[model samples]
Target: MNEIPLEHVHVAPDDGVEDDPAPAVFVLHGRGADEEDLLPVAAELPDDHHVISLRAPDRLQDGYTWYELDLSAGGLESSQPDADDFRRSLDLIVGSVEAAVDAHGLDADRIGLLGFSQGAITSLSLLLEDPDRYAWVVALHGYLAESHADLDPDGIGGKPVFVGAGAGDRVIPQSRTEAAIDHLEALDADVTSGSFPGGHGIGPQELDAVVEFVASRTA
Candidate 1:
């Protein structure tokens, strides 16, 4: 993947709550979706938040992807980025968070991460890679990549996280979801996980839960 800069759009507080630095949430979209794809979802969050949706660096047909997809002789497609690429993306995202905080005078302690599918993969990586930097994580219809399972589970330190999946998501498979949730629990993370009666998409129920999660974390 060529190294193009990460692009994004942001939504500032609408509640008129003025602070030296407000809190923020980073929104990531699934594969084949652009940064703006999740703007509506971000908009549904609390008005006091600075919501930012990021575009993946790589272009794929009409959308973008965070990594190459490998489907050859595969049970399912998988991300093929090397460790360095993943780390570089992490650094880029973290840098963006820092820059957003500085530029908007946002509260660093309340920064949160949220994503659906592929975006959730990125969010999970960052949340697990350094839970201390983020206040909360909401991973929807996604799982933790095995590549990151080696991190010190103790690092989670009971951090608040929510992992929700669809009962009919064949693409992700129930096994992956179980493994991801199990891994988080084994590490003693403050995890709230469940499966909805749907497919690979989010519905109103999930949205309600998301709103609640964001409200609690940002409060």
Candidate 2:
């Protein structure tokens, strides 16, 4: 299938090596946010790797969305993703990442993923769909997509993953994040997780941890 070209902002490495392909981190923003939303967070990451912040394909409210949510199950906490839309977004992301690698001379094997909310769900799904394709992942304020529960991908063992959630996150309850952690641990993934005291958003402490986690892995 052809890749739907995603709009993005590419930040070149501060100290990139001329001949060596630079490692990369792909940033995905939460629902209703744009590619520019996480540029500040990207700025805090290690300066030796390339950072690409992508815009979601579907426009939503004044921003964008990776996929629509099905809230009939209850509310945000119990909501599920529209399965077909989720799968389509996943494929598009895969294609976009591949294209980015080629277009920017990236080190594909050293790729990382950092996402928030709905974007976080997509990042985790991508990791599960093909573990070897990513070097590390940071998922914040999001739960695992139910559609990927049946997948049992190989090579996920020992992959680095960081899951963060808000203790008071009504949108995606703490239990959901814990479940994702448990699943990753069961698969032998190198998991590091934490919870902040706020609601459905990243706190200062959470941001610090995320920065540290990504730096350690990328460095």
Candidate 3:
């Protein structure tokens, strides 16, 4: 087993496994939120999969951030990510996932990613960079980063992807989410998407859809 590159909290399966390696879910929280922010959501998932929530490396006000936002071009809704920081964080997350699989005795082929906001952007970027590495993805309230717009990875065909967005989202904007869905669909990804009434946050309906999407794939 190797050392995980990021700080994280791990929850073992409710039904302990003695022989088989368990499926794993990596949870990445939004900006300014710690690993524990989405810990409670793990309880709502299937009892047999390993749940690991990772803390972003860069520290923000009272929490953490995956990357810094570059607002020089426009307002928060139109801002882009700091290219250097975004790339660095993407590499770190990939390394962390690799190390975590070995450390936790997880099923490497069944790994899933659940990320929110900036974390969601990172997850989508990761999937685009190496489509075959992950089994499935859940990106909530985030847009596709422009940095990866030119990528046309071969293995992304029919890959399961869940993208949830807030219709009233003022931070990232609903149009951004729509653009991501369009891009993924263009790549032939099995994209399942939803839009809720809130703003930059996951609602109960969205959460239910997420749980169902994950369960269907992981089961």
TM-score of 2: 0.95
All candidates' lDDT scores?
0.79, 0.90, 0.91
My TM-score estimates for the predictions, one after another, are 0.90, 0.95, 0.97
Model 3, poorest ten-residue lDDT window? 13-22
Candidate 3 lDDT, 35-100, residue by residue in tens: 999887766887888999999999999999998999988889888889999988899888998998
What value does the lDDT take at residue 219 in candidate 1? Answer: 70
Query: Judged by lDDT relative to the true structure, which candidate is superior, 2 or 3?
Result: 3
Q: What TM-score does candidate 1 get on C-alpha atoms?
A: 0.90
Q: Provide the lowest-lDDT 10-residue window in model 2.
A: 13-22
Q: Which is the leading candidate under TM-score? A: 3
Worst 10 residues of 1 by lDDT: 73-82
Check candidate 3 and list the clashing pairs.
Answer: none
**Highest-lDDT candidate:** 3
Off by over 4 Å in 3: 17-19
Off by over 4 Å in 2: 1-4, 15-19
